[model samples]
Target: MNKNEDSVKNSEFGFGESNDAYAKYFFGQSYLKRLASNSDEKINVSNVSFEPGCRNNWHEHSIAQILIAVAGEGWYQAEGQVAQKMLPGDVVIVPAHTKHWHGADKDSWFAHLAIMVGDAKTDWYESVDEAEYEKLN
Candidate 1:
């Protein structure tokens, strides 16, 4: 494939190995690569990748969470709100204590860089049921 072809074909392919430690917090397949993060730091960054149809469970942060879409497409939704489609360059700021869930669209792999701030702690709730997620499509 030519460069352009390669890019287009893999637009929905996630990079990196599967992340295991936090797998329990998510649904389907996802991976994590920490870039600049420390337990003592007020802000940390990590790159996360999600397989097609994969997503994290509904959760809330103690302070704030920022998501920067880096590749493919996905969805982000807060409690009681319609799911927002996320594409490259899209940024979502999740304020402290607001319930939200994010992940790849049904046919696309998604990836993003997550900037975590404040206490960087999260409280996870229930998994997003397949039927509920499919509604956003």
Candidate 2:
């Protein structure tokens, strides 16, 4: 099997079911597993997994969001900045309203813990341009 397939098969956090609800905002298949949620405490956390070449569209949160890379490899990029390669233990602190997109690398499965700092309302924008994404290693 290819690296992507192998990684998925041996994923650390179990890959949840297809993220159908947000499929429209992604390029390829993605999965979501809620790790924690407390309406009263306004806390939300989820484990998100991406298939090879999968990426979410450019988007931003009303409040700051945090991403902790938990498995395999991925890429994270904000508007007007170079994409950041993500590996296990890497942490990204995205400021509120920063237009950004993130997902698996072209040849690897990836997963991250998404922590919504507050009652964040995400606003999704256009998908990452294919030409631009293809430029990445």
Candidate 3:
């Protein structure tokens, strides 16, 4: 792992490894740590961490998704909406099928617990518009 990946892995959240499996869907480096999953219970939880300036592509879930910010700062923006700044303890409830994206701020690492309410499938769309993202603070 490179220096930045190593530092993110050792972040306060201490969640999963470098998220290479889904790297293609993200604009920059991100880590994934699966915290819980139960087929019978139909529940899934993961701690996702992003390096500074890292963000995922626009996507939507078949079911609602809940993101609880655990460390640093980030941005969450739904289609046609202004990006929302997120910090520790901030929560974002993303309605099912909403085109949106979330990731670390330009100068901060970000971590959040993603709780999947049920057996949700995600449909990833194009990357967030670069010009639009750069406009965010």
Best by TM-score: 2
Which pairs of residues collide in model 3? Answer: none
Model 2, range 17-105, lDDT digits (tens) per residue?
A: 89999999999999998888999889998889998899999999999889999887899998999999999889999999999999999
- lDDT tens per residue, model 3, 9-123: 6656576888999999999889899888899989998999998899999999999999998877899999999899988789999999999999998878888888986878999
- The parts of candidate 1 lying over 4 Å away from their true place are 1-14
Worst window of 10 by summed lDDT in candidate 2: 1-10
Clash list (residue pairs), candidate 2: none
- lDDT, model 2: 0.89
Query: What lDDT score is found at residue 109 in candidate 3?
Result: 82
Error of 3 at 6 (Å): 11
Q: Would you estimate the TM-scores of all the predictions?
A: 0.86, 0.94, 0.90
Candidate 2, residue 20: Cα displacement in angstroms equals: 0.4
- Candidate 2 regions exceeding 4 Å error are 4-12
- Model 1, residue 11: distance off in Å is 9.5
Stretches of candidate 3 exceeding 4 Å from the true structure: 1-13
Pick out the ten consecutive residues of candidate 1 with the lowest summed lDDT.
Answer: 1-10
